[model samples]
Every structure is written in C-alpha cells, then in structure tokens.
Target: MTDHIDGALALSWMNTFTEDFHAAQQALTDLDRQAGDGDFGTNIASALRKVVAELPTADDATFASVFTATANGFLATGGTSGPLFGMWFRAVSRSTATEGTDTDLLAQGVAAGLAKVQTLGGASVGDNTMIDALAPASQALLDASTGGLTVDKALTSAARAARAGAASTADLLAARGRASYVGDLALGVEDPGAVTVAIFFEAGAAALSA
Candidate 1:
C-alpha cells in the first residue's frame, strides 16, 4: 500500500471530490435552503470547478501545489464559508509545503487546517459549522498517524469521523455561520459546510484506496 500522497494522488482526490460534490449539489443546496442563504451548493461547486481547471498536470503535481491551487480557488469565491475554506486549505498547503507528503504529514496538514479554521471562524466542534466535521476528521487522522496506518486506511478513518460529525450537526442548533441566522429553523437540517468536509475526506479515502 502507498504510504504517502503525491501531487497525482492529491489531484485524484480533488477530482473525486468534485464528482461527488456534483452528485450531491442539489441535496446540499436544499440543506442550505433550510438554514442559510441557500447558495452553499452553487458557490462551492463553482470553487471546485475552478480548482479542477487550475490543477497542475499529474507529471508536474505536488501535494502543496494542488492544495495551494484549491485554496486559491476557494479564496476567489465570494462568501463567508468560501474564504474560510480557502484559509483552511491554505494552512493545509503550508503544512505540506514540499513536493511530497506522507500520511503523517497529511495528518499534520489536516490538523493545521482545522486550527486555522477554528481560529479564523471562532467556531468549535458543535458550532454547526464545517469545523464540526473538520475537527473530528483531524483528530481521526492524528490517531491513524499515531497508529502508523497507511494513507488509505488513515483517510478512511478520517472520513468516517467526519461523516459522524456532519450527521451530528443535524441535531445541533447553529452557534455560528449562516445557519445561526435561522435559529431553530436549522435544527433538523445538517450543516452544508460540515457535510462538505465529510465529502472531502471521503474523496481522499476513495482516491487513496483506489
């Protein structure tokens, strides 16, 4: 099994994420409609498309390069969640900051991304934000790294954690982000940002496992 993620793998992960996101776009939009401004799906879809278009060729790819491109794509998008996701990806790219990245390195990048998001957004685990999924996924990656697992297994575990976190958001009252504006109206709906985080880790797992 592979122990590291390179540019090619990173690109594949993003492509997988894009495909999955496209499939779930309407569902995500519906969720956002019940909570926020209802543009989460469309905005994020545009960002991912831009990221895919700007991705480096596999021959010239590196973990940092791909993630940096992703960060820039999201940063270019207009909205509170978009730029927050941009900064999170920015931190992940900085943590890699090199031509290659191992599972442990990727875990560090995820952790850094989580920290960057929380610090910038002022939302903790139960804030009904992306951080809900990101925080648990980061911890799962850290645990997997400590267990010395392969990249696929590590990412799979992180994906599971993120999914659970996203699911938890449905039962939570919004404490931050656009959902907060809706009050109890968002109670039964999952946070789109958190679900996106789950989709991200699931894509990473699928890419690495394949």
Candidate 2:
C-alpha cells in the first residue's frame, strides 16, 4: 500500500525512462523516418543523456528537483518536441514542488503537464502528435486517482492508456507536428513523440512496481 511516490522513486522513474528510451532509440528513429526528418530518436537520446548526467542523488532529490532537471535537459535540446516536452515537465515540476506526491496529486501534475504541452505546442488529442498519448494518459491518471487505485495501479493504467493512444496514431493522418508535413504518407506510421509519451508512462509504472 504505497501511498505516495517519494523523491527516490521519482528519481528512479526518470532513470528507467532514460534506459527505456535508449533501448527504443533505433526503433523510434525508424518510425520518425516515415513522417519526419528522422532525427527524433537521436535528439531525444541526447536530451535523456543530459538528464541522466544532471540527476540529483536520492538524498537530495525532490519531485520538483527531478522534474526541473528533466525539463532543463529537454529545453536545452534542439527541435520542436524537445522544447514542448521541456515545458510539459516544467508544469509537472511546478505542480509537484514538494518532497513527494500521492497518486491524486501526481494525477493533477500530469494533467497540468498535458495542458501546458497543449498550450505550448498547440496540438490536440486527435492531432497525431504527442498529445495523442498524453491526453489519454492524463485522463487515465485522473480516473485512477478518483477510483482510489494504488500508485502502482494508477501509473499502470495511465501507461496502458498512453500505449493505446500511441498505437492509434499509426492509423491516423497527422494533423499537426512533423508528421503533419507528410500528410497521408504518415498513415501507417506512429508519431515518435506519441510513442515516447507512452514509454514515459510505462517507465513510471515499472519504476514504482519495482
């Protein structure tokens, strides 16, 4: 009955996300090649590498600190998605500007992050952007929190929803982002940003489960 994710757990989540992204980097780049400039995976890998280098120790870590480091890492990276993700994590940092966060609070942070991403990126759920995964994941977190699920279950639910949303992007004609530039040529290709969002939630779930 872990009721909250403390600084240590939050740090672990970021590390896991970094590892997961590294493993998926080649695949993500290939996916992006179908609809974008094909540098998506390399760019994100660069950002995560910076994030890992800047990660605070568990003893010094707080939700705000961890998220802020992540935000800064992404912000320093080049490209549209990188900066958008930076702002998204920045909002999450603001929401969880404390030592720890319960599932309900985490949900609020994720929802706030989603809102910031949407505002900054000007993309919506069906736009075949990262919002495709982020929007559903945000809603899933809110639902899980309201339903009184444990932290692990709540994160798992969000991860599931995010994966589904990312998968859906494969069938979509991109309405925004780099994929949009390719028009129907991206019909069978999943947006790399959306898949990355799913990976983020999945890493969160795995981090808490461990």
Query: What does candidate 1's lDDT look like per residue over 1-210, in tens digits?
Result: 877888899999988998999999999999999999899998998898788888899888888889999999999998888899999898888766455777788889888888887888899988899988999999998999999998889999999999999999999999997889989889989999999999999999999989
Off by over 4 Å in 2: 97-99
For residue 148, model 1's alpha carbon misses the true position, in angstroms, by 1.0
Q: Give the worst 10-residue stretch by lDDT in candidate 2.
A: 91-100
lDDT tens per residue, model 2, 1-210: 567888898899999999899999999999999999999998999898888888899889988889999999999999888898998888777766355788788899889888888887788878889999999999998998889998789999999999999999999888787788889899989889999999999999999989
User: What is the RMSD of candidate 2?
Assistant: 1.2
TM-score for each candidate, following the candidate numbering: 0.96, 0.96
In each prediction, how many residue pairs overlap at the backbone (N, C-alpha, C within less than 3 A)? Answer: 0, 0
Each prediction's Cα RMSD? Answer: 1.2, 1.2
lDDT of each: 0.90, 0.89
Alpha-carbon runs more than 4 Å astray in model 1: 97-99
